[model samples]
Target: MGPTDTTHTTPLPVVLAGARGHGSWHLANIRRLQDQGVVRLAGVCELHPLDETELAAFAAEPPEQSADFGSLLDSTGARAAVICTPIQTHAELALTAAARGVHLLLEKPPAATLTDFERILTGVRDAKIACQVGFQSFGSHAVPAVRALVRTGAIGTVRGYGAAGAWVRDDAYYRRAPWAGRRRIGDTDVVDGVLTNPLAHAVATALELAGSGAAHDIASIETELFRAHDIEADDTSCVRLTTTSGLPVTAAVTLCAEQAGEPYVIVHGDRGRITFWYKQDRVLVQRAGHGPEETVHGRTDLLENLVAHLTHGTALLAPPHRTGAFMRVVEAVRNAPEPAALPSGAWHTAPALTGDGTRRVVRGIDAAVAAAADTLRLFSELGVPWALPTEVSSP
Candidate 1:
């Protein structure tokens, strides 16, 4: 099973499920890889066939397009499936692909609940198919470099880590999808909060940096969830994950920022620290006795990694098992109390950049979020008068 293995010399046949919305990225990526002879987009499974506008961009004769996913796989004989569907549909669609012995590239925040996640994991394992979870940041080369620095004692004894993300999302963002900003849809748990949804990469990458990817690695979780928007989920949130060894990883994030900045995670050791801007695949390292060093790293596309794994003996970077600790965070958010709304006085409204409507700006949120991450304290603990104590429990 080496790169030179002749058994997999040809490009892998693949299907693109949910080929609209976020799946559109996959469609374009697949087309790009197809041109390089790494993989072939053999089929597309969508409720409706891609319209002329979407189809026109295909570089080659598009494969079969159909509404039935299982049928698409069988008909196209696709060996792999990339699923970028809704959060709730993930488990069922993934199971469908796994039952056919088709490998998978499932999107992030893997499933709606632990039960669904387990079901998908069990099915994929039983089928003996390679399943790569879609946390694209996991494929970033900078992530491993930082981890290696920590393990090599470049920063000394790891004290903990912190992450902060501030971004703006207007009414249109929530209106874009039915599940937007929802914690649960009927009996299903969406847990679409700021920490779990939009800024999840920061949280997941932090957990990975902490060397705590399994459920057992986590001892407890403390969550502070809030919303400035009229949605069912939190638009602003913070979480502290305490590992079994008592080290902490705290993250503060918001979708209703006065001014948006790049999201980042900082690994704080006793003598030094490392800051990683996950989106840019950038890293900054500072040790106790050395001047700071910064590096911008490249990323491996998850789809490309999946193809490599199938064609060669490459390891899947973001597998289901590696995301257990993250799913635990999702489970905690699901079981936690509803996100409290920020009082009107705590935030003011202003016209959004597009001049279409208004946006909520939580007063002093930027400083408050940074303080929480830097001090490894929750919002309430940081003396934010309007902030409430975090809800603490084992995840």
Candidate 2:
């Protein structure tokens, strides 16, 4: 890992901030791209330096590591940075990278609040550098395919959309870091809820499939937030949106599932429906006059897309502007009251097979989550026994 490759023929040198937690995935991905001659890991900004064991994958040319992010960027001359830091730090770090004219592959939930989202969105727009938010599902080729199907009336006329995510997270999962499940730390907002962070793709994808991925595209939103965990943020939640086009969208997600399974977004139409398991880039279409049809579409990695966008004039996917509508959802979750804790009998702890820790299981959550996506209804609307009253976010 070395200085920025100013020549277009050379690979872009990229620095990574927050090398622990979710950043580890970015580290391995960087190594893969480095092997492909797409980019170089120029430096790492971690509070504590990653030792040889942690840097083993980069043994051939270990990147410089430092605690001071700006200094590391200046010293390494990094042309781009993949930021997977805590939610509250995104705006400042993005501005810092922008000030240096460095491109960004910022992680999901790009900001903790609308103010910060707007700040970073404006700074990067003014900087005019390629800034791809880390909502990787947007890079799925199935996105266009699904959109094309809807446009051609492959699903007849579009009615609405829904998404479901049911994943298991044990008690230890929330203890992974100081900010792991916090909505706010002191006066700063973190908003690391189920919809805002871990399963954010479900929310953003449902909105995008409706051709409404901008701030103005969202006419209004209604949210139902709940948590089985002892932490501040919601581990189980859902949101319903009315787009400017009058299309309906909903996302139901829970980290307290009976079992972990692939998350998906579905488009509902009068004559048919299209289901996209975004993680696997898989799609299934079912309608009248035909049997069920399924296809696995190829996906474009967001970071790789950013590199190609810079070097080959390719279109940028998951750009900041493309996530404005998602930010509105984040804003709503932020202003909503703290997640209502599940009553004692509504959830029970069960030990995980892998032995990480005991997981909290919300009774019938898997079916409830799936039903919301299948019917475009929230948990309460579906009459789940433990659901709280819905909270509406003003337009």
lDDT of each residue in 301-385, candidate 2, tens digit only: 8888888888877788888888999999999999998898999899999997477579999999999999999999888999998
For each candidate in turn, the TM-score is: 0.95, 0.97
Backbone clash pairs in model 1 (N, Cα, C under 3 Å; residues 3+ apart or in different chains), count: 0
lDDT of 1 at 67: 91
Please report how far candidate 2 places residue 274 from its true position, in Å: 0.4
Model 2 ranges with Cα > 4 A deviation: 1-8
lDDT string for model 1 (317-376, tens) is: 898998888888888888888898998888888787775977888988988777777878
Best by TM-score: 2
- State each model's C-alpha RMSD to the native: 2.1, 2.9
Kindly report which residue stretches of model 1 are placed more than 4 angstroms away from their true locations once superposed: 1-8
Clashing pairs in 1: none
User: Residue 339 of model 2: what lDDT?
Assistant: 92
Model 2: lDDT equals 0.90
